[model samples]
Target: MDLRGKYGLLIDDIAEMRTTVRIQLADSGLEKCDAARNIKEAIERLSQRRYDLIVCDYNLGQGADGQQLLELVRRRQLLPLSSAFLMITGETGYEQVSTAAEYAPDDYLIKPFTSELLRSRLERILEKKEALRPLYQVLTDKVDRAKALAICDILLAAKGRYVLDILRHKGQLLLESKRNDEALALYQGVLDQRATPWAEVGKARALAATGNEEEARQHLQRALDAYPNYLAAYDSLALLLEKTDKTAAQEVVEKALKVAPSTQRQRRLGGLALENKDYPRAESAFRRATEKDRTGFFKSHDDYAGLAKSCAEQGKIDDAFAAVKDMGNHFGRSSDLLARQAAVESLVHVKAGNPLAAKAALARALALNDDQALDPTTALEIATACFATGDAETAKGIIQSVAEDHNENETVIQLAQGVFLAAGHGEEGAVFLEATRKRMIKLNNDAVAMAKAGDLDHAIAMLTEAADRLTNNCQVSVNAALAILMDVQRNGAAPEKFSRAQTYILQARRANPEHRQLADLAKFYRKLAPPGTPIIEET
Candidate 1:
């Protein structure tokens, strides 16, 4: 308990809870403790500085929970590998989700516990982390599997109490590096030693990766049969089922939801139910998710829209409009929100036999759109409304744009197909989707050919033009930005080209801030620019 120099973060919505946890940490001899009332503030604090530990409550008011915060930190590389993250939750539902999560906190503590218990859990996690600190340090550097393997060897040779954890970590690293055969061997070795559910799941994943689908499924089923509440197993099994039997996948999702209900789980269930045209089930699940997720970062407006769609489909037009109103109330009337709400409202009006109101709503939605690039969810909602309101051309345009942007995604394609079917244009929608996808593919191919043929300027111009036309296409924008970056790099990033590259980077980010290539391009932009210069404009 000699925490002489430790500093930590405490996150909770309640002021009293923050004070209590701060006092507890201070009593543990920590030098300083920072407090955040919610995930947004917690993210700000973490970004501004580092902490030795983060004691986060499971529920942090609205817009994100502790788990989502942990994921953001991990995904964004905001935390040092040496940092210890401890989640405190009063809900038992957390156990199922935690166990199945690909990334988990160092440890979790259920609330209504004594300070002594909290300290004990913290100490144990710290000890384990310290034991594997070297391996973690190596992982943070470059993800070189050979070095990781060497470190794993050293740790395994000690044969300590954390042997199993080390083995599991090694197996995961192997999986990340695509060394599935080696990872399978590692999992098999663990299975021989102990029949742990985690090992079984890992083995199943490896088996699946090795193309032994049947064997993989058998192992997953065995794990689930033995540990009926194993959420991760259910997740994998559901994914496997999705490729062949959506009904089976829905069942698997339902079972997992029963074991541990979460906003994400409810949303997934709603989506599956909607896909199956089980309007009532989708309505119920989407309503539950939207209600419960009011204060979480993972909240999606899609849930509300889905609820509205369900209500409209089920002849509850009034409830559909109410859902739209609630969505506007909760998320505000930003252009995006307004556009989606207007679209759903139009559909609701149409369902209620009010064509004039529906037309007016559609006009409002089109006005709000103003050429903004649409996310798939919003596009689908808008398309559905357009179709319902007898605006087939607009609906087809939206669907075609979404298809061009996300043609490779089966889920989006399926959803688009469903929308077309609901609008009685299934065949036309199918043909349109295929045609748009082909056009996009050809456009991408031609751009690549231009670049490869040493027509760098032509490639850059072509994709930039495509970016304007495909305003909502993240891939097209990213390609344009990357093309500009590459051309700049070839010429030592001349000032003019650097500015153009920076402009495209900003444009791409505005289109899709989370696009994968934006980060790489941003990093390259920084290296090319003057020190401390900002590449992304504050919007």
Candidate 2:
């Protein structure tokens, strides 16, 4: 229970508050501590080094709070699962600190507490973290769901103090592994034992994954009615609504934002509003996103692009131009950023009825956009600009390339569809993206069929070619790596072939580290390759 060896961080914007917390923490026997005055510094420290614990103030200044910081770190994997997070808040902010966090802090303490109380809270949270350390170790590491789930089972069998926590992780693993029925059973069992908000949302996710989308939506609506502050349910419901009704999805996101002002959710709202043709709403949402984090870490090219497009739609030419220009100032000059600015500027010019300027900007953007290296978001922006400038063929071609390269990425596909929707080609976009999806699926199936039919050379060639062309496609890269590993199993492991396999495997991992087939394939390679052979290092 002694904290002498532990390192901790105190995050508070007010110097006096940080000093007070530090004094208490020191009194609690934790001598090693650091202090970050704001979100930017907190993020910098977290990225630079590991901390055993973080004691953060809930009301960080500049509209960026500790909860958002927690969410950011957890999503980016900057904060390891073994590290404990304890939120310090005043009584008025206690309700918010307790609920509405997309990623919850491990514990929270009200202000005006004694050092002894602070020590007790720290000890309790650290103990829970320590108890879950085995699972976190596997979870934090690159894909090893099997080991993680096994640890869940061991912990559950022990009936430890963290049973609900263990079950939560177990359910998530089952869902991620696509063991829908088992996941459903687990969530249903948890709900039966006691009605927890996460269990209900988990059950709903399981339902949707098992092809019961309607039931999932209904369950989520009920969950929202019961636990209105649950952020995850709102997110799940909004995603589900997007499949059926974009307007309802926008409304759901709006409600979620009212509960908690999230930059990411605001961006989603802007995207949805744009789709719904609600220009003013889109502009407002995009503006919030662009202006939320004074620190540049959370600013994105898409936010500015969305703002400009929304403003242009509402005939705010000067505002639209300002947004496009502002994007250039915030982000360092890069080819991709240049392309993004030009594309957005072209759209603004076209809206202002200046065809010559629009075409000129579009041309510049196109010249800078390299299909292979351009990111999906920037590529789609260029495509949208192409559509605006009356070059449907060029836009379609660009969309096709981005769509094919990121065929399995639903977000990119949706954005590409949004471009077509804005261009008045909604039906065409739908058919085009669907065709691209099928073509990519068939490409994989054909190579898989060839490999199964004992045509190793042709199959490997096809997959390797597609993997090289579509560097962002996880499925193609996985198939290429699998084909190579299969060949290695058939013929003895040649170092060069294994090396090629390793390359494709890493490509797949980079594209999508959570690809279903990656862990098994990597494990197979490790088992087959000679000990002295260079293998893929675990990240």
Candidate 3:
């Protein structure tokens, strides 16, 4: 296969490896080749031009390894779908290279292999890519699920030795289309004949999609036990635990990290630590991820934010400031990031007996947003800043807004209540919360009645109108909308109507915290909709 027209990026820290690969590619007729000695240069090159192939070394000193680079490229949508990624890993042990699956490179090549082996692997990947060009084009263009399915059907009809591969692709397309039942049936059919890890994992994913976490956990756990180094199983299991059991989730993450210490795994572990409020562990994990994958997916402004938060919580003011400063330098002053930095800066100022500067930082953060409302997390940080600076009134106001927006969120409500109690306003806070709840109930009751009276159009109109009117009752409005959407779904309306209902459901969830019934309803409606249909936006 002549590769004269194909562009390639060769990334390796080892000069000899780079030279050898470059020569091999050139010899194989790939004339348009570029080489980078490390990830930083490779990323810079990638930013400047698109390449048909990326050949990266697994080990890159002081920067992103091959796995991390691949993940970053994929997650950020930096690489074209047709781009071929080949990981050249020196590690022979399955455990050592298991994390590579999490990134899902186009192919992998064990180092110390003959040129013939490399050529064969590259040819195989190219052949597969060529075979799936139509599918890839649809996926890349974000075409409708129905269109993608049609493409898959056409490909599958051409019987070949790669029929199983076609089945796998079709299964994935079905899942993406939200046809969990069909995907699950296909996966089950495959599993009935053989113990395929991919098929089992797909089944577990379908289970999760249908809101059967417990069953999904069991399936994934079984897969993990059967194939200990099956990295996909670990990823799915971690996702399940993340929603239900944080401790168990941490354990799964730790296990995956031990099997293959990729930057992505470390980043996930850091996220879990942050959620658990284990500041030290969070800091360690985030720092390690950033260091190991300097140019990888985990290296972003958020890592610095996590580090700063951990440092601030630990009272390491200077370190926190340094981290924040570095973050600002890397990614110009983002309002959210600056809000967090301001809060931590306020804490440091209060500790230093400089109240004025603390107040100024808060004002600047608020100003950056044109005085618009902050998100729950930013509001919490601002409240913390106010409390530290003895501005109880400001802190209370921010807390009130957060509490209103997240009334159904037990965690946020509890945190707000705790802050009030700590400040000796427990009784007052309780009274305020009670009044807020009453107002929310009344608003929801009114909306529900309108919806139940065969006035769906009017009810939807009311709900949309009420969104602004019930600004102080965010959760109430969201729940009301969700209730109406659920009713629409149960009625089995037109496809367009169902899509609109799904949109409202998503909007409601995004506006409020997690609600069990609402989540279930949203998932149900999603399953009901056909694959690839555009979800209708609710007016």
Steric collisions counted per model: 6, 0, 1
TM-score between model 3 and native: 0.70
Worst 10 residues of 1 by lDDT: 530-539
**Model 2 lDDT per residue over 130-245, tens place:** 99999999998767788999999999999978999999899999998999999999999988888989999999999999999999999999999998888888899999999999
All candidates: TM-score? 0.79, 0.94, 0.70
Pairs clashing in candidate 2?
A: none
Question: Which one wins by TM-score: 1 or 3?
Answer: 1
Per-candidate Cα lDDT values, in order, are: 0.80, 0.91, 0.72
- In candidate 1, the residue pairs with backbone N, CA or C atoms under 3 Å apart (3 or more residues apart, or in different chains) clash, namely 62-295, 63-295, 63-296, 63-297, 64-296, 64-297
Worst 10-residue lDDT window, candidate 2 = 94-103
Model 2 gets an lDDT of 0.91
Models, CA RMSD each: 5.0, 2.1, 8.2
Model 1 error, position 315 (Å): 1.7
Ranked by lDDT, the better of candidates 1 and 2 is 2
Residue 367 lDDT in candidate 3: 64
lDDT of 1 by residue, 1-539 (tens): 45667778898999998888877776667667888888778888999998888898987765456776787787778876678998888877367436746667888877776777777777777777788899888876544567888899899999999988888888988876778999999999878987988889989989988898889988898899899988879998988877677788889999988876677888888878877889999999998898876554556788888898889889988889889998887775577888888898888898889999999998888776557465677778888889888888988878887777665566888889879977888798788888888888788778878887888899999998887777656678777877877786675656667666666676666666646566676777766676544456444
Pick by lDDT: which candidate is best?
Answer: 2
Error of 3 at 267 (Å): 3.1
